[model samples]
Target: MALIPKETELQEGLTTIFEDLLLKKEGVKKELIRTRKDFNIACDQHIKSGFQSEQDWVNANASHQNKFIEYEMYCHIIDIITDFKDIHGQFPEYMEMHRTLSQIMIKLAQDEKYELAAIAKLWVDRIESTIQEHSYC
Candidate 1:
């Protein structure tokens, strides 16, 4: 029988995306489990803080021209997820999270929160492609 995989790979990918622009300058991956309201509150706070802590306020504010979060980070974040399974072995739990994340992205996009969804889309697409590629392996 083929071995089912663990979630370590998927978990790592999701964590990287969370840290980029969650409205909270500092947060953990598990925070994603919170309600949408809580997630946005955190994202708003992080964006308002200018993506850095108070200690580096001046430099950070000046370095970033975007007053609101943008989808640019999605590119790099997606790239990392694409390499995830390779770094952490494949597992069934990993697949489920990939699917769930895609669903979350859809909801976020429908709500017009495209910045984060843009990243999710790439991750989801990558996951689908990977699943297909490995289906017969």
Candidate 2:
């Protein structure tokens, strides 16, 4: 006999999604902290007041590119995170699903059809909830 649908499965999936989001939130917070520390270190090493050491090099005829490279690097990182947020619609479930879809594919290949179907339905529900949650965005 086929397994009948269960609301419990979606509830479990949502619980898992919530935990994953909390973990991701912590990770992003840690990354921000690390970036701030690195910025402070760079400021101490290269910046004198409002001017950078590289400007001194320029004054002395040194051929350094200055903080142009550093500026570009920061922009690159911001672009990457911005792109991630844009594509994921600010929902951690999008990232959670991205990470899990490969495993879901593998399970489907192994003939775990019921499990795959349940997960797909769970994902759809999560997506709907996310749309509703972020309707103002």
Candidate 3:
């Protein structure tokens, strides 16, 4: 569907020349239409990703180069906390995070990212405590 701009303050600034280019040049008009199509495609894909919130998008893109320890840690932590709040308890997700962090902790500790390693270790400890306190029946 062609988008017809309604009369508004921005329409008042259309300034004639811009409209002429769009009206007279088929290529310019086609490109403008393509932009809208591209935008809709992007929105559809973003919706399909099961994106929960802005934080989920941020964490998904936070990895740098080939290193992913920090972003992985952040995602796992958020998952645990969000699940805890939503369910009034927890699940095995934290145990999986503990395993992943344990594998990376050594490398992180040896590098400048030791602080993050420490945080992951602390997260593991928290998961352990949660499991112990809230034993499964």
What's the TM-score of every candidate structure?
A: 0.39, 0.36, 0.32
Best by the TM-score measure: 1
RMSD of each: 12.4, 15.2, 24.6
Clashes of each: 9, 0, 0
- Candidate 1 lands at a TM-score of 0.39
Residue-level lDDT tens digits of model 2 in 78-128: 333334343423433444554454454455547755544453444445545
How big is the RMSD of model 2? 15.2
What is candidate 2's CA lDDT for residue 6? 41
lDDT of 1 by residue, 1-137 (tens): 96555344444444554444343322323332333345455556666888754434443443342322433444344444454434444333546656666777888889997867775676677666655544545
Off by over 4 Å in 1: 1-90
- Expressed as tens digits, the lDDT of each residue in 12-107 for candidate 3 is 222232233234344434544555455555556567876544454443344221134444455554544444332423232545544655666676
Q: What is the lDDT of residue 19 in candidate 1?
A: 42
Candidate 3 lDDT (Cα, 0 to 1): 0.47
Whose lDDT is greatest here? Answer: 1
Clashing pairs in 2: none
**Who is ahead in TM-score, 1 or 2?**
1
